[model samples]
Target: MDLEPIWLSIKLAMITTVILLFVGIPVAYWLSRKQSILKLVAEAIITMPLVLPPSVLGFYLLLAFSPNNGFGKWLHQHFSLQLVFSFPGLILASIIYSLPFMISPVKAAFSHLPRSMAEASYMMGKSKTQTFYRVLLPNIKASVFTAAVLTFAHTLGEFGVVLMIGGNIPGETKVASIAIYDAVEMMDYHSANSYALILFAITFIIVISVFVINRNAVKSPFE
Candidate 1:
């Protein structure tokens, strides 16, 4: 069995999870703070991927990043960056597709937190930034972990969006999910089953961990 595809999927998931951790915290924090028309709009956009078809997102991204189009053409001419059907393109699409997974749980955690926490931190002369990082984030660590794990797991099984944007480029965009599809297409059930079993085991473990984490979080006195 070629483990390259599995390794590639793991690499992509790790990178995507890490990036979402940093990016999601700030966005989730902002979204949790208040309710407004603009916030609603932003939240809707962020959460759209949860329901949006991966192929649709992939198609738009493909057009946006295609060298034949304006945005892609500009990037190609100015910086010689090509995203479509490339590894970088896969990373970008994954990030967008998985944004809500990283943000929703963290935002829920943040919203459930007491206002007194931030207020007390402010009274102590801590900057909003400092308070958010030090006081609030510590309390929501479990949620953050859940979000990260969910994002990692989601990215690991990505198929439609990745296939549309990255296609199958061995050792590049040929992740485990795509490899499974190719194997099935060629009637190589052994390889396909191997990939499926591995992915199923990995995702199952990750999901179980999330449930355990959430259960513990709910039982924690601090929560």
Candidate 2:
């Protein structure tokens, strides 16, 4: 069993999770603070991948980024950047595909926070940025951590979207999930089982950690 696929998955998940952490934080925070039809639409778009089929997102992404036409052609001609069937494309697709996992929990946490927290910070003359980083954000550490872990785990198990955008290029875009599919197709049950079991163990641990974190977060320190 080549470990390359497993390692590639981990690398991709780590990169995707890191990127989403930065991207999701501001987006989630803004969404939490706003209330408008446009914000609702934007939230729906962000949440679309959760309900839509992975193949649907993958297909549209393929069409948009395929070097044969559209934005992909412009990117290729100008920047020499090819997205479809590449590692970078995999990252882009994963970010879109796993965005809600990173955003939803954090957004919910933000929404649940008392409005007075921000008001109190303002009374002390702290800027919104300062209040968010120094005052508000610290209170939702558990949710942020949970969102990051969920995003990482979700990326590790990606299949349809990755298959369409990245294809199965060994040592490149071939992640563990795709590798497992390939193994099963070849009737190599051993390799498939190995990949599945590893993913299972990792995700199980992640879920357990999430539960523990949430439990601790909700538990009173005095108790």
Error of 1 at 46 (Å): 0.8
Q: Which ten residues in a row have the lowest lDDT in candidate 1?
A: 214-223
For model 2, residues 37-130, the per-residue Cα lDDT tens digits are: 9999999999999999999999999999999889999999999999998999999999999999999999999999999999999999999999
The parts of candidate 1 lying over 4 Å away from their true place are: 220-223
Q: What are the clashing pairs of model 1?
A: none
lDDT of 1 by residue, 72-123 (tens): 8999999999999889889989999999999999999999999999999999
Candidate 2 residues lying further than 4 Å off, grouped into runs, are none
The per-model lDDT (C-alpha) reads: 0.95, 0.95
